[model samples]
Target chain A: MNTWNVAKLVAAKDLRIEARSRVITNQVLPFAAIAMVMFAFALDNENDALLVQVAPGLIWLATLFSLLILVQRSFAIETADGAIDALRVAGIDPGGIFLGKAAALAAQLVALETILIGAAVLLYHTEIRLGGVVLLVTTVLAATCGLAFVGTLYGGLAAGIKGRETLLPLLLLPVVAPVLIGATRALEAAFGTGKAVLADGWPWLGLLITFAAAFGVVGVLAFGPLLDE
Target chain B: METIVDLRDVVAVLGQFPALAGASLTVLRGEIVLLQGPNGAGKTSLLRVCAGLLPVVRGHAVVLGHDLTVDRSGVRAKVGLLGHTNGLYPELSVRDNVQFWGTTVGASSGEIDAALDRLGLSLRLADVQVGRLSAGQKRRTALACLVARRAVLWLLDEPHAGLDAEGRDELDAVLRQAAASGATVLVASHELERAGALAHRTVQVIAGQVHEVEQ
Candidate 1:
């Protein structure tokens, strides 16, 4: 088994575990859906117009929280059976473990984003052009890549620490601020809400891509040390 | 014989505390060295050091001919550690848990099945989730991983802690078999009587230092 092969195996194991447990499918997705509904109700005073106007931000917010939960669950499972130690001693490349985790997180976040996007479309009565749809999907993928990389990096850092569940967000949220801003701005431009920044949308997309590529590489390199005890 | 583990005044700190406070010991290939110690005596830490899970903060330590201070990760591929925890995924079936570990180390399917069979995990039990198994069964599944791994150095911490009489016998047989195959086994256990019967030699730990015990 090579590095990528091992990573795929690890990710497949996680996906299988999730498929059996349905912890994310059953719990996290509903939590995201309900939270998005709450956002709609909270801003009900502004009616559908206001809700649709801010749909991009609301969707991104929901995805961010969902990503947090997903990352926590991913690492928590590794600790359940001393899986972390197992990974360390198994002799597989540590980078494989990191990439495996990040890949799994990205897959789950993409699944969650699909559901959240559907909910956003239905509840917010949002209208998106064909071009806007392309931009939205691209933005989600880039942002998810960056988020998954950072989340996996921070997840390993926070594992086994006191109050790690609480500590993870503190470590993660600040670093992902750019992802949120870039993703939302790109989405906004896609929706024609960023009238003056329409031409600038490409730059925002570039930011998302850069963040993804940078963190993806760093996470692969840094995961080995972070995972080591 | 080549030395599988050699440590000279090794100091390994866990948090603010020194788990292996100037600990030192050596084991040649194919020897079953029993590690006996009381609680907080650093037996577990010593095994971790040998398995390359812990870096020696000071002094000299080498495992499987790989220096602990240099490239600990290099030793990991050939070393298998079965700690107090079963380290098998609770959600995964006995088969899946064993398969995961076996596949990680590039073991063949035939080897995996042979290990499971050797550990007496029946076809029925093989599909059962680890959480559903008794503690003894979980330990067996964990042992199956070590068998499948066929590692050079086996570091077992409390290998007999949760086993029944039959499980203990099975584990002893496994340890003996591993040793006969030229694998070095370092076991940390409080069960001195059983461990003594299985080990070629016994080394007790006290306050993070290793001392030889006369058989």
Candidate 2:
């Protein structure tokens, strides 16, 4: 079977399910938004300058937490009715399945990140410079891809295992440390926090790109074995 | 008759437990073989092994001309296995679930529609989410997906469990039609009287071993 076609089909199926279920929009999104608000409230007693300085890190921290929930939700669908086994038996390419799931996850994370960034702008009074728009967009895309790839990979690893709900974060958090740090740093630069220049963020974007590419390759090759296990 | 499945002393493991210990069975094309065994007798493991979902640890096994020991994934596309769960997405409509699985095998829209009709899933029912359907209806939907797949080998485990009398009759008819079209079927079921009537041969699975009954 053509991997591209299978990827498209799987991605479309997942997105369609998400659209119908409304779990991401109704539950995960609100949870993420609430978490962001909580972060802002935690810093309410602190000075406004401190909140502005830390807005990027706080936004990404919320995104990372939400990533865990999104990953759990994505794999839950496959294991809920033993649909993963059906997919395996159908002989759809494992790499295609991995890519399809990751793409869908990336799409969802993009939406989540967009809202979180908006919330940060309003809650933390962070300013966006014209020169940083390209950098910020690039950082979001790259970091989202990195997180999605890792999430899908680890989610597949934890799928079908007893206690996977708890196991997923354990297996996932350390692996994504680089993404959290790299994305936060890049965003800090893009947002002109800590007096960092846009040029400084480009190097961080390189790390994000490499992380995404590495996991993308590894996820495609490893997903089959993980799914079987 | 061409051999559709050949397993000689197949040994399969689930974790540390030997799910299939020295099991041997052979099935020919266009034949329906019933696998009857008590719980934990390795019946599902055997079907999974044949479908390429389970590994053959130490055995010579081939299904649909693919050496499973060499490449278990190769035969997967040509075989359909229906396990305990219906394998239908609960959130997706009956038609969407059927269409998704059917699309994997390159089944056309016409084929999907025909499969739905064959399973007695009316257009109105087809539009309903599988989660909302009755147990028998969900089974029918999963069967519709298998029908649309046009698999050369069918591996069904307790396929009649949740099905009603009419649904069971429909399943029997679908299996017969598939076998007549040269598809091999290996069904593990407890409903011996019902399954035995539809099977061309009956094999007993006792403690992960196969013993053919003189039918």
Candidate 3:
């Protein structure tokens, strides 16, 4: 089997496994809803440039947080049933497993981002046009890839440590700050532009793309040593 | 037949403590090798290093002509390892668990079912979430991986940990069948007499070194 099938099978199995948990939806839906509610209260129906300046970042941040909570695919079940060793023994590459996990997390992130955007429109009076929509989608995809890519790597590292849940964010936040910063800025620029121009935006966009690529590659190589340990 | 596992002065130190300080052993194709030791005699550690799970601190283990230190993934492909953990998914039903893992290792559906049958895991249990499985059944589930994907080297760490008499019997049967198929089997066991039944030879691990048993 090629790398693509390895990734696909891993992702498919994870989704099917997660789908069995009726509580997963219940757990994720609230995170999306509340983030939107927080936006209304914090923004107070204001579209001031400062708030709008940061809106994309704020929304992306919320989505990332929600993904962090919802991305329990790598953490929760493995601790309980010892399912991860099956993957280790099955000859699946740790990096491929990371991609499988990231793909699954992205699906959840997309669903949550949709809710957040909807909430932004109804609650915060956020203006979103066709260009804005395309940029929003691109930003979230890149941002989520950054988050999932980094999150799954630390997830493995912290799996064996004490206070892992708490330890993970601390370890990951610093590594992912660049992506968060870059994604937030790109989204703001995406909203501010008149011609959907990307003169100033590419730097941040490039940072995000670079972050995802670097994190994905390192994750693939390092995960094997960590998994075998 | 080529020796599936050949270790040369392999020493594994975990977190400042050396588990296998200067251990060496050779396991050939079609043999069941038992590693008997006290609770912390490095039996599992030695087996893991041999299976490419643990890195060698001092020396190297060469399995199937692949160095465990250099070609760990290659060693992994040719070996089936049951870590100290059972590694089952609590949310997935038993059948999904087996099939998910079966496909991951490139096992055909029929092969998975047949392996499950050999382990005495009922088809009905396939749909039941692993959270509901009894400890014995969980061990059975972990052992079901024995037939996962035709791995030549079966590295079982404490395979009988939670098994009942019947489960141990099932494991013995699998070991015999796997050896018959020319698969090299290495089991780390605390159960002395029972493990002796599974392997024609026993290597006692004492203070990170392995030596053959003498009459």
- DockQ of all models, two decimals each: 0.79, 0.86, 0.54
Q: lDDT of all predictions, in order shown? A: 0.88, 0.92, 0.75
Span of 10 residues, lowest total lDDT, candidate 3 chain B: B142-151
Using TM-score as the yardstick, the better of models 2 and 3 is 2
Q: Give lDDT tens digits, candidate 2, residues B1-215.
A: 99999999999999999999999999999999999989999999999999998899998998999999999889999988899998889999999999999999999999999999988896689899999998999999998999998889999999998889998999999999999989999999999999999999999998888999999
Candidate 3 Cα deviation (angstroms), residue A199:
7.6
Q: Which one is best on TM-score?
A: 2
lDDT of 3 by residue, A6-108 (tens): 7788788778766887444787778667876776567654445445445666677777677557654466776665556556656776777878877877776
Q: Mind giving the per-residue lDDT tens digits that candidate 3 earns over B12-80? A: 888888889899998889999899888889998887787676787667679878877776667666777
lDDT (tens digit, per residue) of candidate 1 on A1-229: 6879888989988888888889987999999999999999998764577887788889889988988899899998998878799788888887788888889889999999888878988998766767677777888899989998999989999997889989998999999999999988888887766352455567898999999999888888888888885
Docking class of 1: medium
**What range of 10 consecutive residues in model 2 chain B has the weakest lDDT sum?**
B117-126
A59-134 in candidate 2: lDDT tens per residue? 8889999999999999989988889899989998999999999999999999999999999899889898889999
As for candidate 3, its clashing pairs are A82-B87, A82-B88, A83-B87, B95-B126
Off by over 4 Å in 2: none
lDDT of 1 by residue, B1-215 (tens): 99889999999999899899898898999999999888999999999988888888999998887888988889998988999787777888998988889998788999999989989995779999888999999999999988888788999999998899999999999889889989999999888999999999999899999999998
lDDT of 2 at A80: 88
